[model samples]
Target chain A: MSILINKDTRVICQGITGKVGMFHTKGCLEYGTQMVGGVTPGKGGTTVEGLPVFDTVAEAVEQTGCDATMIFVPPAFTADAILEAVDAGLKTVIAITEGVPALDMVYVYEVVKRTGVNLVGPNCPGVITPEECKIGIMPGYIHKKGPVGVMSRSGTLTYEAVWQLSNLGLGQSTCVGLGGDPIVGTSFIDLFKMYQADDDTEAILMMGEIGGTAEEEAAAFVKQHVTKPVAAFIAGRTAPPGKRMGHAGAIISGGKGTATEKVAALEDAGIEVANGPADMGAALQRAMKRGR
Target chain B: MKVHEYQAKQILRDAGVAVPEGIVAKTPADAAAAFDKLGGSIAVVKAQIHAGGRGKGTLKEHPDQRGVQLVRSREEAEQVAARLIGNTLVTIQTGPEGKVVNQVLVEAGCNIARELYLGIVLDRSAAKPVVMASSEGGVEIEKVAEETPELIFKEHFTPDRGLDDFQVRKLCSKLNLAGASVSSAMRFMKGLCRVYSELDCSMAEINPLVVTADGELMALDAKISFDDNAIFRHPQLKELRDRTEEDPYELRAGDAGLSYVKLEGNIGCLVNGAGLAMSTMDLIKLHGGEPANFLDVGGGANVQQVTEAFRILLDDKNVKAVLVNIFGGIMRCTTIANALLEAYKSVGFNVPLVVRLEGTEVEQGRKIIADSDVDIITAEGLTDAAKKVVAAATGATA
Candidate 1:
């Protein structure tokens, strides 16, 4: 009942033999993600943790029926890799690669919209459906099957919130890293809608940061459509305007995208917001009390 | 990444945008020559920098025709140029450490009937490059936004899909534009788009695209910022970065491939996790002292990276102290400590350095640093390290 990936989701590792790809693929396999195959030209016929490898995405899709593709390719080749995945008709693409060119993301948007495949990130940690499926680099120990739906722009903070949630024994339904690039595959609104429809997800925990209109757009959607109680935490409370804060997509530009603005937007939409970084779990717990 | 006004105008003229005749000057002598080049009585001496505060300051007018009035004379021009040459001149249009000026624009002042701003920049929300037009363009676009929000007109363009005839017509109609000016602006954007696509630009702007009484859409300023990663494609722009005007720490950090942005704070941050880096800064403040800079030598920093990071961090005079918060993760703490000790020996800093190493190899890393005899204060927890830094910097009990 998660938003993106689940038990039945067949996945492909785009740069399977690469360091990041190999590391996360093993973790995903251990977490019970349905790792069907991998794509790395010239590394075809090799097996990583017993998963089949193909030279091309087209071949991998044809042979193994991999539905989701997690890309860990280098920045320069990421665009081509994404185009290839899109061409092969992958319904879900999660990019663990960072620093993909903004212009390249424009192409990703085009390919996703034209092909109707859900593209997750160019610089995100990735999506995790707790114990059902673990994609990307999130520490598998911190997440488990629960009713709370989570989405974040920061990869590490997602881990932080997940650790906190798991500590409370609340677990999670789906935690999607929408990515922290100036432009990304999906917006918060798109993910929120999916979470809203899932009955298994009783509440949503949106982890946002300063920058872009994604959170505001999500708040608007929550106000109009989402029936589930939502709690949120916007990072960069101490960050100055226009600073990168590590994530490429995260910056307070033109004084528009600040923690204050985001928290207010969420609060105005009737969602609960933590005062700062430490109160994320407490905020969600408070929101749940009110929702009933 | 913003190019100077004069430099940007030259690029615009090359892109076929009609621009006013201008020359960059370094001295009042240079200004006189440029003034003569105009074949007119006056010239505009602009303090060319990546920032936008020059207009409000003494940067917008020509030097006095006679004896050097530091505000208007050749000697004054020399003095102004001297002070501004390598320093970042803060401006309104631009923010912070301005675009460093290696050259100055000594131009023939425009005979303006009206001033308008026409800018094309990345629109974060729409995830598209937008062309922003303001009829009230002479003043800062921000002022126009705060006072008269209705004056700003934004027209977005998808880079692959070029602007069409209708958009051009609408832009002209909204601008109340007329004559050859319309065609020229259209040609400029078309060529500009060519440059934007070909050069891989993040933003291309023309502030105060002056509509002369003579009827021309003359480009008064050209400000272009290429995507930093895309700079490799446009090898020529690599020469445009001026480190002289930058925070010494930022320059050194950049050279070392670490993301370090200086702030007016007392606590120094060295965190393994990017998210942890920020959270550490907030927590540092929560414990009562500001963070001096946002420095994250991303996960798994080796000896050279950590040393370079220390060198950069110490360069910040604003950083009264440092708080090394490492949630070891996959990054080896031993490597960071070795680097820290190496940087300390090389830089010979007397400032207090507090290290909080957690996760894998913490004991081994701490033992290495301890063996180095570098006199670094080691903390067992995040809160303990933050308190140590705050006390060291502000002389207050944390």
Candidate 2:
């Protein structure tokens, strides 16, 4: 019933021997993510946490038959690692690594589109399907198996929303962080489509910010396609124009990509916009009740 | 990551693009010498600052002084440079405070001709680099794109594959260029595109790409910014970063591996991840408190980085209280808690402190804060943390 991954989905870790890779891989494994193997170039034939290791993604895929991969490579080599994963025919690749060059993502985005492999994030907090599996760096304790689908463009911000949703007793069917970069592998439209098709996901909660036209474009898609009830929160309402708040991509340029504009677009599409950060849960609860 | 006009022109010229001969000078004597060296009977003295609209900008100290001046003699160049070098130039782009001009660009002025706009930007929607050209130039391209959309033309280029000849030719036709000027313009645009890709530039703008009186193609002005993520690939390009033009606190924070932006408020926020930091600031403002700065310790920040972030926040005089919100993802709550105590011991914290720790090892993190001798107020959740921090800030200020 999960979108991209479940308990049975075998996973391969890229750059598994590195500090961050090892730490998060351990975390994911502890959450029962079905870790089969990992890849770390020269450190092949070594085991970090009782899993087999190989030199390249192809070798890891061949040895373990893993369909999904968790990339924890450094920012400089993340683009090449993603292309390698796609070339190896991995069905899903979730990159927890941040700061991949925007130009590199341009090429990776094209290749992934042609290959049909679902790429979640280059600067994101990977994906989680509650108690079944977790592929990102997010803490596993806050999630519970339920009906709502959560998606966001931030890491810790996503955690905050999920924590609030959990407190409100609206456990998530799945949560995905799309990453807060100028360019991302996954968009709100893509996640919305998946959520609409999944029967377990009765409602969707999106956390967006001011930056690119992705939110606007997603609003257009939701109006035309998505049938599920959707509640949204757009951050940076008070952010001054033209200043990049904290995210590299979250800047209002040429008088476009403002918070007010995004909120208006979402509202125009018949989606309910949360009044503020603390009001998201209440708004989504109302939307879910109204959907049926 | 944006470079001044003189620097942008140098990069463009290196890639074989046609640009006016220019030299950067720090003093009026240097500018006069450069004008004479360029065989100048007529030259342009331009104040070098990051913001655009310098041509129409006026000096802050002397209202009558302009940023860009056309001088016919060496003495005129010296006089203009002297007026601009030590003065502040206020432009439409630069705020009311404006930017201090430290250098002047002296170049051989071009003959009368038609001005056209040329630029390459990484279009997020297309997921590709796009080339934009318009018949209107020497003015804001944004205004033109908004007012007369059809006047601007665009061609998308794949990152793996660069711009082709036909794409450039098609763009030239859209500019209404014909004859030898068309071919020359095509070459110039293509060269600029090459520089854009090779340099890993996020934006490469040649505003007022002019066609000379004698049918020559020349780039009259250049504004370029490189992708910060891709800066590691190009070490030589890193040298072009103008530190003086940047905020000193932000620069120091960057060096310490913390993403920090100075804001005018009483509450200083230190959080993990950019999105969380922003939301934290929003929450503070919503709770009737203003955030003094936005500081993201990042996902993998260690004890040293955390200590530095604390010091930076404490250094701000307006900050009456500090809010530390950490969600243990790649980073653990216990690690951050230890760093907080260490920072307090070394740098000392005189301001009211509100700390909220969640996620992995929350019990141990809370225990560490409880055990510490330093005065700290712990919150149960985000809402509690925001309310407590706002109250502490107000209480202190009141």
Candidate 3:
């Protein structure tokens, strides 16, 4: 009943020969993900971790019938790898590589839309359906299969929220990292729809940051459409204006994208807002009670 | 990845966009020579900094002196440049501490018949590059958007197609441009759009897109910022970065592949992930303590980056305590623990330190810290970490 991915979803790794790619591929495999094969351009016809390697995504798909892909290509070539996966009819493409050019993402966003493909991230930890499957760099032990669905714009922060929830005896249906970049493949609204439709997901937890109106837009959408209880924690409240706090996309610029404004928007939409990082679990508890 | 006005004008001019000719001068003598070379009776000397609102900004030492001033003679240009260069400028954008103006741009004055506002930015909601124009110029665009929203006309264009001719024409008509000015506006706007896309600009703004007496459209002021993620493709744009305009600690952190921003607080925070770093700052503030800086060691941060991050955090004189919060994902908790031990031995932490490690290999990481002889306070959770760090920073018993 988990959204986006589960045990039956066979996946391939792009750029699986690289150090980071290989390390996380093994991590995903150890998490019991259906790691079928890998693609490394020139390094085809090889074997790694007892899995076959192919030259292109198409070949990998043909040989293994993989329906999903985890991309670990470098930033410069991440867009091409994503397009290759989409062109090969991979239903779900997850890009874990960071620093992909904004223009490249802009073009990729349009193509992904035209082709009806679900793209997860270019600077994110990827996705996980608790014990069923894991397709990202997030720590696998912190998650437990349950009713809550989590989505966030950060990696470690997502882990923080999940840890709090799991410690509070609330396991997750799925956790999706939407990435920290200014331009990404997925948005909060897109994931909200899936979480609302998933039978296993009784509640939703959203983690957002300063910069951009995505949270505000998501708040508006949730108010109009979502029936599931939702709680959110927006970071960067203590951030000064015009200063980029770590993330490239996280900044208050031209009097816009302030945390104050985002918090006000989320609260106005009837979503429970966490007071701080430690309050995420409590806020979700309050949201679920209110939904009942 | 923001370029100075002079640098932005140079980039725009090279991209076939019409901009006022300007020369960057680091000294009064260079400014005087530039004024003389321009051969104009009236020239503008502008303080070159990364912030905007420079035209209305005032010098801290000489409140009567403006950052941007019109000079009648070469000596006047030199005098204005002398007052601006090496002086702190306090603008609406720059904080009260002000930014040190290291250079001045001396440019020939423009004959402005009319002024308009033009800006190109990636519209996050629309998921496309948008060109915004307004007849109200030489003022803050935010003010216009807030006060008279309809005055701003926006046109969204895809990256591959760029700004279409019809979009430009529609904007010109909306701006009340007619006759030869319409065609000039078309060329100016289209060329600017081309430069915006080709250069991977995050924002390209002309506060006052001036229409001359001869019906020629020119960019009187240019403020361009390229996408930092896209800067790798444009090697030439990388050279345009002004290190003097940035904080030394932040620059050092960037060199070490850490994302850091210096803030005016006492508690230094070193954490993983941007969101977690910011949330750590918020928690510190919530616990009645202020964070000195925001430093994200980043996912998969190795021993070197962690050690460097510690050095940068400890280097801040305002820091009274340091907090390390790591929720390991791709980055393991043991790696952070080992790095912390390495940093404790190499950099030597003088400030009271608090560490919170969670996620993968937590026990091993905690064991590493416990086994080490370094003095450290360990917390179990995020709330405990924040309260302990705040108490430690305030010199109170926790």
Candidate 4:
């Protein structure tokens, strides 16, 4: 019943030999995810944390029968890694790499669409379906197994929202970090539709920021097709204009992509908008109450 | 990452767009040369920087033989250039910090009928470059958007597909089609899109495109920003980067290969994950401590990024303390400790450093830093780390 991933998803690690990749792969294994094998370009046949390594994602996929890849390669190579995964016919990919250029991501997007493969992030925190399967750098202990599905573009905002929701006993069925890059592989609309179809997911907590029309488009999408209740928060309401803050997409360009605009759009779609990031959990609770 | 107006236009022109003739100047001599290049009768002398307020300060001039006039100068353009050559121009548009002018753009002034703002960038939701057109061009499209949003039309175009002719014509008509200038604007838009896509730009904008008194659409102002991550591919962009305009610490941090974007804050943020770094920035603000910068050494940071992050924290001069928040995940705390020691070795610090460590080998990480010769303090949790950093910044006893 979980959204994008469950316990049975076969996972392969790209850049499994890298320090960060190896650490997180071990973490995924500790969480009891099916860490089948890994691909490290030149370090084929090596073992990292007891997982077999192959040269390419295709080799790892062919040898291990893994179709889901979590990429931890550096920025310059992440786009290639994504393309490799998609070309290998991977069904789902979660790229843990940040600082990927928008140009690189645009190509990755074209490849994903061309290959019909789903890519999660270029700046995201990765996805975790609570106790079912964890595939990111989030604190596993803070997340609890539950029914609400959380999707966010910003990492800290996502973390803050999840921490608040977890503390309030409103655990997430899956919390997907869509990444905060100006260009991302998945939008809120994509995740919203998935959450809407997951029967185990009762409500949604979507965290958006002041950059891009992703939230606006998602709001428009929800107004038409999304049946489940959505509670959302758009960050940087009071943030200074034109400054990127942290995320590449968090800029207030030419006065558009403001928090006010996103919230207004989300509210107009009949979804409840939280007052701020701090109230996201309670906002979800209220939306759940009203929807029921 | 934003390039100046004349540069954007020149890039547009090089890309085969019909843009007004312009020249870049670095000094009064260069401005005078540019003035001569534009036939010296009438030309626009503007300060070249990364912001949007040349109309206000000594940044703009029309130097003539008489003296320096902001709008009607021929000689005063020299004074404008002289005054701005080695000076800084502070504007609300440039954020809390202002941009330094090492160059000035001198161009043939345009006759105006209509002014508009047009920009192309990656659409946040659609994940493609979206072109935005506004009739209220020059002053601030944000104000235009706030007061009148319908006038703003966003045309989404994929990079691989390039610009659509129909969309370009449609946009030109909205910018107000009267003459063949509609074609000129369309040409400029498409050219800009080409440069945008080819350059791997994060944003490219032309604000206040004036329909000159001569019935010609002219881009009076331009701004261009390249994706910093992509700058490595283009050596020309790397050369164009004015590190002098950035925080010395931030520049140094970048040199250290860390992702650090300076912010207007007092609390220094050091985090492992970019998402966590963002959350730390927000939390710092929520807790009443402005983050000095968004520093993400990225996951699996080693000694170099950690120490560079620390040195960057100290370099902020405004920062009174440092908040090292690392959620180790698979990254061991011991590595964090080694990094702290390494950073301390590279740059000795006197300010308070708060280390918040969690995950595998957490105690080992703590032990490494605690055992280091460098003074290090531990936080009970992230919130506690934040509070401590705030306390240290404000000289409080919390």
Candidate 5:
């Protein structure tokens, strides 16, 4: 009933020989995800973490029949790795690498769209369906399998919300970190549709920061199609204009992408907005009451 | 990541796009020599800064001194350059603090029969590179879009294939370009697109794409900014970065693999993740405190980065308190706690400090901080941390 990934989903790690790749791959394995094999060009026929390593994604997919991939390739080669995965017919490709060039993403976006492949992030904290599967770098212990589906454009912020929900005795159906880049593979609206369709997800929690019209667009989509209870927290309200607050996408630019505008949009859509990060769980509880 | 006007023009000229001949002068003498070398009836001395709207901007030191001024004599060029190169130019884009103009671009003036706006940006909405054209030139494109939407024509092109010839022709026709000007516009638009894609530019704009009396289209003003992520591929473009135009703390943070933006406030923030860092700032403000700066130590930050972050925060004289919030994911809480203790010993914090650690290895991290005799305030949650830091910063009991 979890969206995107579950216990049955077999995963392969791209660039599994790299330091970060090996570390997270073992983490995922320890969390009980089916880490079938990995792809590291020039390191084929070798094994790490008791899993086989292939030269390319196609070889890994063919040998292990892996349905999904977690990419840890360097930013310079991340786009090509995603392309390789898509070309190998992977249904879900999650890129955890950050600093990927926007132009590379542009080309990758076009190809992914043409091929109808679901790409998750290039700078995100990956995805996790608590208890069933862990496919990202998110802490596994803070999660519990339950009714809420969580998604955010941040890494640690997502962990914050998930931890708060867990503390409230609320578990999650799945949590997706959509990355904090100006150009990410997945959007709020895209994940909204999936969370809405998942039977286990009775409510949705979305976290957004300033910069870009994705939040506004997601608000519009939620108002029309989403029937489940929904709550959101938009960060960077205190941010000054024209200053990039850490994230490339988190900025108040051109008199647009302000937190006030995003909050207004979400509230107008009838979604409960959390006053702050600590208030996210209570906000979702309020949303559930309203939905009932 | 933004380049000076003269540098942008040089890039444009190298890419086969027509631009006004310009020389970058670091001193008034160089400017005067540049003006003499151009040997034109009129020349322009434009102050070199990162921001746009320089033409309408004025010097802070001398109110009557404009950033961009037309000079008929070399002596006038020298005077204008002298005023601009050593003073701050306040513009609509630059804040009231403005930016110091260390150089000036002296270019030969041209005869403009008409002016139009042309720009290429990585349009997030369309998820493609878009070329926007408008007949209303020398005006803010945002104003033109807001006031008269139909006046703007756009063509979205993929980075792989670039803008098609037909798209360029359509844009030229939309701008009412005819005869020789049409071909010139084609070369200008296509070359600009090439520059955007090949150079991995985030934004490439020409404020006034001028049509001369002889029906030649030229980029009168150029603004080019490369994507910071892609700069690793272009070492040459990386060299174009003006260190003087940036905040020293921000530059230092960049070198240390941390993301930091200096703000005007009292509470210094060091956090993990950009979103969490911003949220920490928002929470601080909500609790009646202002944040001094936004610093994201980033995922997988090591001991050195944490110490560096502490040093940067302590370096800000406005900071009265420091808050460290970490929600470990790829970064473990224990690693951050260890880093914090390490930083406490190495950097030696004077300001009242509050730490909130959560996520992986939380218990161990808390125990590590609790066992330390480093004089730290520990909070269980983000809200508690914000309230405590604000109270401490304002010298109130929490």
Candidate 6:
């Protein structure tokens, strides 16, 4: 009962000829994700790791009947790749590429909103449905199929949380990395809604960092819409202001998007916020028990 | 990615935006020559540093020297420049260890009828670029937004199409601009918006968009930052990067395709992804330890890059212990382990090291590390790793 993907979700690869695309496509295939075909603009009619490659996304979708596409194109072409996927009528697109310009993402958001297609990340670690399907670049060994759904704005941090939860025997239903970019296609609100609707997701473990008002808005959405128990963790509590902190979106500009503000907002919504990354597993455990 | 005020003004000027006539001077003689060339009785000599509040900043060595000073004569301009150049100027933005002033902008002073703030910033909530205007111009816009939010007005604009007529009109009316000043403001804003979109700038701020007593709109001060990701599309913009403004280690790390930040701790960290790097730092602090730096080798870093990352961490003088946390996803743990051993062989492991690895081929990764002759401590989990590193760093038992 994964929110976005399962074993049956057929996936096509965008920029499947690239080095990263080749490596992760093989990984995804090994994890049991249905690799239908791939799209490389000029390198159509080729094969990568035994998967057929088409010139355009439309052709790949037509020939393979794939419903989803995972993008590993470089930054310069990522926006266009997303637009191509949306234009071709792909229902879900997961972009693992990092460093797509913020302005480009602004336009992508406008287009995706109008088309009503779900887009995961341009600088994220993709999404995983544990054991059933994995589209992102997360370690598959640690993730186990379970009732707790996890979401984060970071790549390795998501792995850390998921690993802790799995070690605690509280595996995740689906884990989504929302990308650590200033502009992202999906927010915590978007995932919270999906997790709430998914019957298998008994509790939600949300990990956020100081950045945009996405966390605040998600808190508002959870208060109004999500009835499922949710545990939250916000990183960069000890980080200084104005530093980029590795992620382009991790800066606290104009005194906004501080860790304290996000923690306060989440607590205001009756969600338990963890003290640190290590405490999140226990926090989710408490939230799940309360929900039961 | 932040360009100096003079450089930002040059960009805005090239984009047809009206900016103050100025010349960059590196020395006192150059300042005097620039003042003479401008042929103004009064000129403003401003220090060129990548920070705000320069007008109020004072030199660290000379208490009487201000970063920005008004000079009535060419000699005064030379004197101000002499006091500023080769001296550290401390501003509110720059910490106590202020940036050294290598250059100064000498410009003909303007007769200001009124001071107004104008800026174009990428608004994440709206998912668009917004033009922000406030009557309280010269002061800090952040303070104004915090104390009197209503004083500031914003108009969101699409990047491809740029500022719409309606948005420009709304901006003018909201700022109580009318008549010739209205057209002047409109032209200035349109040009600024063009610069923002065409150059792919994340933020373009004009702290004091001045209206001269003669009814002309001019950008008195400009601070612009380009999107690092989009810098490839605009190759010319990359030339504006001032390596002097950034930490040497961070700049080198960037060149090596690693994200690194030096901190005031003794425990060096190498991890994958930004979030995990930060979490590792936080955990190190939680366990009574301070992290010397934050280094993310990224998701696709190869063995060579990992070795370089190790070299970078070891380069930090304060590093007494090092922690390498890798959660292999697309990056293999075995690859990282091989790189770590190779880096140790080349750089020499002079510090206590702790490693916690998980994910693909992790068993093989652990076995390689175990088989290696490098003195390394492996942890079972993040918490245990933190404790081990902290204990090693502080000379306490694990």
Residue-level lDDT of model 2, residues B7-115, one tens digit each, is: 9999888888999999999999999999999995899999999999998899988889889999999999999999999899999998888999999999999895799
Name the top DockQ candidate.
5
Candidate 6 lDDT, A1-292, residue by residue in tens:
8888999999999989998899889989999999988999889988999999999999998999999999999899999999999999998999999889889998899998899999998898999998999997887888999999999999888988898899899888999999888788888888988999998999999999887788899999888888899999988876777787888778787899898899999998879888787898989988878862
Candidate 3 is graded, for docking, as high
What would the per-residue lDDT of candidate 6 be over residues B1-398, giving only the tens digit for each residue? 88999999999889888998999999999999999999989999999999999989999999888888889999999999999999999999988899999999998899999899999988878889999999999999989999999999999998888887778888888887878888887789989999999889989999899988887789999999999888888999888888898778898899999998877898999998888888888889988899888788988788688778878888877788999999887788898888888888888778889999988789999999999998999998888999999989987322
At residue B264, candidate 1 shows an lDDT of: 83
Local accuracy of candidate 5 as per-residue lDDT tens digits, A1-292? 8899999999999999999999999999999999999999999999999999999988888899999999999999999999999999998999999999999999888888888888999899999999988998999999998999999999989999998999999999999999877677889998999999999999999999998889999999999999999999999999999898877777787788999999999999989999987899889989998992
lDDT of 4: 0.77
Q: TM-scores of all models? A: 0.89, 0.97, 0.98, 0.84, 0.98, 0.97
lDDT (Cα, 0-100) at B366 in candidate 2: 95
The B-chain TM-score of model 3 reads 0.96
Give stretches of model 6 more than 4 Å off.
B396-398
Model 1 chain A, TM-score vs. native: 0.96
Relative to the unseen true structure, what is the C-alpha lDDT of residue B352 in candidate 4, on a scale of 0 to 100?
Answer: 82
lDDT, candidate 5, B376-395, per-residue tens: 99998998999999999999
Candidate order, DockQ descending: 5, 3, 6, 2, 1, 4
| Fraction of native contacts under 8 Å reproduced by each candidate | 0.32, 0.67, 0.84, 0.35, 0.88, 0.73
| Model 1: share of true interface contacts reproduced | 0.32
Q: Looking at model 5 chain B, report the run of 10 residues with the lowest lDDT sum.
A: B389-398
lDDT of 3 by residue, A1-292 (tens): 8888999999999999999989999999999999999999999999888889999999998989999999999999999999999999998999999998887888899999899899999899999999999998999999998999999999989999999999999999999999977678889999999999999999999999998889999999999999999999999999998788877678887788998999999998899999998999889989999992
What's model 3's TM-score? 0.98
Per-model chain A TM: 0.96, 0.98, 0.99, 0.97, 0.99, 0.97
The segments of candidate 1 whose C-alpha lies over 4 angstroms from its true place after superposition are: A42-50, A242-244, B27-31, B36-41, B59-102, B318-321, B327-398
How far does residue A7 in candidate 4 sit from its true spot (Å)?
Answer: 2.5
Q: What's the lDDT for candidate 5?
A: 0.92
By lDDT, the candidates rank as: 5, 3, 6, 2, 4, 1
Give each model's whole-structure lDDT. Answer: 0.76, 0.89, 0.91, 0.77, 0.92, 0.89
Put down candidate 3 lDDT per residue, B69-108, tens digits, no spaces. Answer: 9999999999999999899999998889899999999999
The candidate, 4 or 6, that scores higher on TM-score is 6
DockQ, every prediction: 0.45, 0.72, 0.82, 0.37, 0.84, 0.75
